[model samples]
Target: MSEQLAEERASARPIPGQVGGRAVMLIPRRDPGTDESMLPPDYQRIIAAVRQAAGPVMAREVGEGVGVDVSVKAKLEPLRGKLVRLVDRGWLQKLPDGRFTTRL
Candidate 1:
């Protein structure tokens, strides 16, 4: 019985923000009426940080809000990737100058 249950669980569909049992770090493109709650906690924070900015923001500035180590190039790269992903997904916009802002 236990083995059956385990097998069933293993075969279940992957959860949102996951694919093939690995967590997806990037947010999906925003659907027509969807909200931030549909995003992973970290992605939600990224959106909130951009929304709260007084103007378009640099990735390093956003990193500060998301608790990343802004001074570390490696740490900032992933955050930048997430920011770019958000831009690609329509949740944020990338200014020509390379800063980011909320789409709304």
Candidate 2:
């Protein structure tokens, strides 16, 4: 794997319950009728924070909502990455202005 890819994977929170002791994706794409309980606790918190927003939100706002220390830029990067992943996986929408909102 590329160095950047490895770093990105390392930064993400590990999903529980391995496949034959190998980790699997706990944050699978949100499908119709998908249960929120299927996601890891952190991912579920991100989704809940976004869903409760009155409008699209930035990564920092999401960090605050989920109790991450938003004062540190480095700390927010992982949260931002998770948000982008959700957008890619059909769990959320990234607006043209780069704010995020629920796809529903």
Candidate 3:
């Protein structure tokens, strides 16, 4: 049982809360390097949509706003990852319900 593995396993444990009939857990991400700049245009667009919303914005909503069909999970998955990275970078806040909002 490596320390890192233990830590990850612990994090995977479910937390208490119900949103849309699903349990929600909020986990922060490890920070990436500071020198990293320049996000893709789509990432920027997603962030902008959340900021404009001025509240929690779901991934599906972001996809819809960006003219991408959220029904296609494959196309939506990459945007979700980018959203998580943006949250880690402090440009956005990821809510426990898998929604996001811009950081003030």
Tens digits of per-residue lDDT for model 1, 1-104: 97787665445432457679987654556756556766777888998998888999999999998899988899999889888887888888999999999876
Clashing residue pairs in candidate 3, if any? none
Query: Candidate 2 vs. truth: CA RMSD?
Result: 11.0
**Global lDDT scores for all candidate models:** 0.81, 0.83, 0.68
Candidate 2 vs. true structure, TM-score: 0.74
Instruction: Spell out the clash pairs found in candidate 1.
Output: none
Candidate scoring better on TM-score of 1 and 2: 1
lDDT tens digits by residue: candidate 3, 1-104: 67776566545532457789997444333344221124445666776777677569888888888888899999898778878877886778888888898765
Task: Name the lDDT value of residue 30 in candidate 3.
Answer: 30
Top TM-score prediction, candidate number: 1
Q: What ranking of all candidate models by lDDT puts the best one first?
A: 2, 1, 3
Which model is ahead, 1 or 3, in terms of lDDT? 1
Enumerate clash totals for all models, in the order shown.
0, 0, 0
lDDT of 3: 0.68
lDDT of 2 by residue, 1-104 (tens): 67776565445553566778887565666655565666677888999999988989999999999999999999999899999988898888999999999886
